[model samples]
Target: MSLLAQLNAPFMYLLCGGIILFVALVCVFFMIRAYRAGKAMGIDTTKMKRVITASATFTLLPSIGILLGVIALSGSLGTPWPWLRLSVIGALHYETQVAEAAAEAVGLQSLSASLMTPTAFSTICLLMSVCIMWGMVFSVFFNKRYLRRLGAGSKSGKPGGGFGDRAMTAMFIGLICAYMGSYIGGFVSGNGLFRCAGSWIPLGVVAVACLSMAGFMWLYEKKNAVWVESFSIAGSMILAMAAAVGLSALA
Candidate 1:
């Protein structure tokens, strides 16, 4: 059987569907438990319902981005895998990066379904599943201690007050800078198989995304458009993707 055929096989779909259903059930169980606990604590049932409704509504908007990510990856990785990944604990950027790297490692120029073999697909799946588990493992084992340390630091009122928040902000900024730097470097160095006029497309997409995000932030901060905050990231991502498609076609 072909790689794509294997990936999108009936068993693959069944497995993915079963896992997703299990996760959804688990989430629902937790939500029910939390709701009951809130009731015990004398929180108004109506307020709780409202909170749930608002959260679900807000979640739908961000999930548009996730849907887009799944569509983007489906072309190369097949639908079932990407759907399962994005529907569960996967981040779009992390999955894309890992998939691309794994493809390269398996001697594929990129993650094209046409070029993928069963061996290459297996390698990508293994790497994606194994490498991403460290974060979850660390959280499970050390998160409490890390949180306690942060709490202690916050209470101490020392020179490094609010160090946790600052550190998180710094880490986020560093991550953004790292991605931006890689994009710029790739464009400048004319590296890999993408050494063409099309190589600049990523940089252009990044610029559009940045500008879209900045514009949303401006609306939120200056015009007090509170609704823009929730949509900012997802909207920018969609716009950036559209820009990429247009640029790719033009290139």
Candidate 2:
């Protein structure tokens, strides 16, 4: 896990993502085969649609959540206001590690060092516990439904690129976001944006990123297209990272 502590962890994550992507394809191939067998067995297919739709639609919010920063960086990009947004998950990952560092330096039992003070710690802990519980339940629900749809039979034929239609879109968005976040992280880190340590940022940047994403969400509401899914998700990741990193830099 020490390897994970380094900012160089992106390379590791990229490698892991590639391996997982391949594994997902293999699983998907078997799923398709089983799904076809279910049809032969005359099983009802309607139940599967809910899981499929949920898989596609659930990401809609978080995608917008990540793009808040990419939009704010518009002026930095020297582009028009409505240019397509990107993501920065690779960079903002520093926060997770930073928290770990602080916790190690000072015991986790010490306190929450954020703006919340003593009371904020409990609220933050409560919120995180809630999210963890929600994710666990959601995972079980989706996994069981998906497995049921795939049927119990095995022995798959040649696998197609059966990645549920969003693989390419997600990969493209992820690769782009990795680069964008790396650049931003490097710039702020090198330039000393957050005092000597890079832990805070100007609120204006946060506001802009939020507003830009909101504007795009509005545009998205007007135009409903599948291709935009990748853009929206990647965009939100970037926006949120930028907001976070920017805040850190300024602080």
Candidate 3:
């Protein structure tokens, strides 16, 4: 390989950044739309900022996890990069006992594929549960925004009557952000003449996240923010899947 090419082993990082940037842009668009809706509904910008920021921070991890998961699904790495696949598969299965029990708590998303086998990219859709779990906490807080807007007053940690709505809204917002962010991530995950640069994903998303939040704040004073769940469960999940793949690079 050429010296220049050698310097950029694993260009997926760039693509990741692009995907993040795109998500932020879309998020801002959605925010403006939501703001308009809020205006029509009398949603206060001051509160909008607070609520959005809170919601974003709460679920940023899951959103990123989902992105990584999607990339994994796409097999954009073609051959699983060098050690990423091995680490992933091995970790998933070795922890089978742990995973099975933990999965029951969240409806049991399939963590069957050990991250060790040949690079086929086939695995269960167990990651969704992770998304839902992280999202649940975020959802709880979101409803508070609505309640506060309705003149219910303010407080945190303690649950309020309108918590459900805020929770649901936060879930919805988280979903949208994750979905939009995926697109941004896609744009910057490779190193080829056409592939995205993975490193760029974090930067792109951060940039977009900052810009979107700023726009919402300036225009309305508001707003809201990993990989796609490691692209599985938790950083802890890395152990089991890594074993399955016969490797443990990031666990």
Using TM-score as the measure, the top candidate is 1
* Off by more than 4 A, model 1: 152-251
Give the 10-residue window scoring lowest on summed lDDT in candidate 3.
223-232
User: Where does the lowest 10-residue lDDT sum fall in candidate 2?
Assistant: 76-85
lDDT tens digits, residue span 1-251, model 3: 53223223456445444555676688789989998888887768877876666566555654555445434433322322212322232232223333344334434343223222222212222432233354456658886787686555554624555666688789999997996676566555445434664434443444545554444444433222023222122322333333434432322
Worst 10 residues of 1 by lDDT: 189-198
True-vs-predicted CA distance for residue 170, candidate 2, Å? 26
TM-score against truth, every candidate? 0.62, 0.27, 0.27
Instruction: List lDDT for all candidates, in order.
Output: 0.84, 0.47, 0.45
lDDT for each residue of candidate 2 in 19-96, tens digit (9 for 90 to 100): 556767887898788778777777677645544554556567565644554344322221121122122112223323
For candidate 2, the per-residue lDDT at 18 reads 63
Candidate 1, residue 88: the lDDT equals 80
Q: lDDT-based ranking, best first?
A: 1, 2, 3
**Candidate 1 residue-wise lDDT at 102:** 86
